[model samples]
Each structure stands twice: as C-alpha cells, then as structure tokens.
Target: MSDEPLVRTVRPGVRVGVDVGSARVGVAASDPTATFAHPVRTLARDEQHGTDLTELVTLVEELAAVEVVVGLPLLLSGQEGEAARIARDYAVALAARVGTVTVRLVDERLTTVDAHRRLRDSGVPGRGQRKVVDQAAAVLILQTALDTEARSGKPPGEPVTTGGRRKKERRR
Candidate 1:
C-alpha cells in the first residue's frame, strides 16, 4: 500500500468509487490528481452471496486504488435503512479484504436520480441506459465526494459534508 493520505490529500494514484446494489455494482475511478472521475465498469451481482464482494475487492486491487469510497443510501429523512445497513456491512467486509486501503462511506442520496437525469439529458436511450445506470451513479457519487473535499478543505476520504450542501466554514 502506498503511504499516501486517504482523506484529504490528492495523492498521485487512482482512487476508486463504488455504487453497490443488490442487482449490480457500479464502479468509477478518479485520477491521482483528483481532477476527474471516469466510469470504469459494472459487475453483475453474483447469485451466490459473498462472491460479488470477492470480485469487487479484485477490481479495486486491479485499479491500484489508494482509497475506496462506497455509497451509503440514506433515506431522505437522514435515517439509515436496510440498504444503508447492507452497504455499510459490505464496506466493512471490503475493507477487511482489501487490507491497508482506506474504505469510506459517502451519503448517496439522489445519486440515482441525478444519474438518470444525466443520461436522459445526454440522449441515451432508456433501455440502453439501464445497463449502465449503476456505473453512472458511481461516477456521481465519486464526483460529489471530490466536490465536497474541494469546498470544505477536507481530504478526499474524510467525511466533511452531510447530506445537504456543504456548510460555510466559520471565519477564524
């Protein structure tokens, strides 16, 4: 594992973002400079439990990611639901499997909606878009994390912003 900081510093290597779902897993990756996030690939969920996670870990390793960000789907009321719990559990397991890489969760409210809108705006056919929705959502999640880090002066892996817009930093 690289000695790079996980949360704030834009280290010189790839950082991975994941949108985990029951049916599919969307993956995105950012450049080391943290300037852009590009959709990588989506993996179909394995019928056998735990198999998909093992695959996910391999994918992360292949990307040579310094940090892993998993999307946590919180309800609009900001409460954890079954999906959130599952995502968190997956994150814990993924962290253990990856070893040495920082695995973090970022609130992923509205990411799917945003991704759908983006695809529609881009003229992607609805039927074709379904295949890649998870990948697009993963990109959105990663982009949001990067934007939050930039605005809040927090490191990339740190949880700085809440569900809403970033709060104004108080003047010293």
Candidate 2:
C-alpha cells in the first residue's frame, strides 16, 4: 500500500475550480496565494470527450494551478445521479492526467441559480451572460470549497490544515 498523502502540500500558489456541464466547461482559478478566484473562460464542448479533457488539462496547467476542485452536480435531494457519476469519472481521469496536482469533488447545488443571479445583478446581457454562466458557477464552487476548508480547519482534499496565515472566513 502506498502512503502518499491524499492532499498535496498547500504551496503558495494558485488553485483551480471547474464547473463541467454536458455542453460547456467552465474554469475559475485562484491567485497564487489562493486568496481570490478569478473567472477564467468557458470552453465549448468538442466533438470528442478526450479532446475536451485534453483541452481542460492544458488550461489548468497553463494557469500553473496546484490543485483543482470540480463541482459535482448532485440532485436537489443531495443524491448522486447520472450527472454526479459522470463528474466523478471525469474528476478521476483528470486527477490521473494532471499527475502532480490534487483534485477534489465539491457538492454543487444551486450553483447555477446563484450564477444566474450574479450575472443579472451585474447587468450582463442575457445572451452574453449565457457564455459565462458556467464559469461563474465554477467560481462559486471554488469559493465554497476554499471557505469550507478554512472553516473546517482542514486543508483542501485531505481535511487537514497546516499552520499558516488564516484568512477571514467567508461563505458562498
């Protein structure tokens, strides 16, 4: 049995969040210090799943992300379904492909609604907003994971935090 750590050491670097949908893949990445999540871009689905995954892996690597948190689409009843299963499979595949980074699956409930609300409140045109809703949802998912890790006294992935500068806790 291998004794490798579940969560990689929290380096002073960027982390990423992803909102994966059937048609679109959204990306959000944090600053190197893991202090802020910035909406990256939404990639439209390619004809092949492998191509899409490759593109996503390239994007994450391009950002120099240390960790990745993928939003798991759970049903309103908090149960896993086909969508959740697919997400889990994708996450595992991504983790393997990335090799050096940590990946996490975070419950994604009401994230779409929240994203829509945010866009509307920000006065984004409906048509233009559609292109980025997934990205916004990804930001929400990443922010929530970061907050949960902070509040639970846990580092992302392994549920433990090393001694370091703690930031003000916030919820999404």
Candidate 3:
C-alpha cells in the first residue's frame, strides 16, 4: 500500500456511470464532451452474472464510452462499509469485463436519498419511484462525478485498479 492518492487525468469523452444493486443495475451515459449524464436504462440482474456483464459491455460499445464510473457507497464517516465492499466487488468484476475502458469508483453518499427527493419533487409516487429510482441515482452519481472533475481539474474518485482490490482495500 502506498500513501499517495492515485489521481488520473479528467479527459473529455463519453463516460458511463453504473449503480449496481442486487436486483437491478442502473446505467447512465455522458455525451462525447462529457458534459452531462443522462439515465440510460435499468437492467434486471439475471442469475447468471455473465449475462449481465455482457449486456454492460454491449452498452459500453454502443455508447462509445471511454470511461466507466461505478458508485461506491461509502459510509457517512468516509469509511468503507459492507455496501462499499459489495460495490467494490461489483466494480472489480465490471473492470475485468470492460477491456481498455477506464473503470472508476466514486463515493456515492446521498445519491439515493437525493434521487428519492427528486422523484418526490417531480410528483412521482412511491410505486412509480421504485421503477426508476436506481436510474435517477445513477444520474446523480455520474453528474456529481462529472461536476467534481470539472471543478477540481482532477478525475473524480479513485481509479479502479485491475488487480481486483479497491482503493481503500489497497491501502490495507
């Protein structure tokens, strides 16, 4: 483990953001210039993980994504929790499948809450929210990442190394 933070250049290109869940995965994509993130779709997870991964690859190819950003659900204290571990595992699995495209994990603290709020503000009821909340959360996560990179001039979040260990775990 190293003390230095791994930082990457924030480049302009199509980027995809993923919010992984046990039941569903939400996907969002940015434009070529990487200005905005829009909700793409939510895919139901099949019993075979390979099938879901293949769909992700196909989506990446169709969108011409240069980067794949996955939401890392860190605790409020900025510590890795159980959900974080699950997210990291999913990200590692995703990274292995996406050849060449950069895979990143960004902290997603209140994205889901914000998504719920947004849906409520838009007058979407609870039942309606269930169908699209994940997608909305994905949008929030990707948009935050894009804005962070734009403001800081550094890539948002930590890059997911190909070694199957997440940034925090690598420190251990």
lDDT of each: 0.78, 0.76, 0.84
Candidate 3 or 2, higher TM-score: 3
Please write out the lDDT profile of model 2 over residues 1-172, one tens digit for every residue. Answer: 7697445233456778988888888889988767678899888866465777788889878987767888888999989899888777777777767756667788888898899999999999889888999999999998887766655556554211112322222221
Off by over 4 Å in 3: 1-10, 164-172
* Best first by lDDT, ranked: 3, 1, 2
Model 1 scores worst on lDDT over the 10 consecutive residues at 163-172
Compared to the true structure, candidate 2 yields what TM-score?
0.80
Model 3 worst lDDT window (10 residues) = 163-172
Per-model TM values vs. the true structure: 0.81, 0.80, 0.87
Report the number of the highest-TM-score candidate: 3
Q: Residues 145-167, candidate 1: write the lDDT tens digits.
A: 87777656665443323324332
TM-score of 3: 0.87
lDDT of 2 at 11: 42
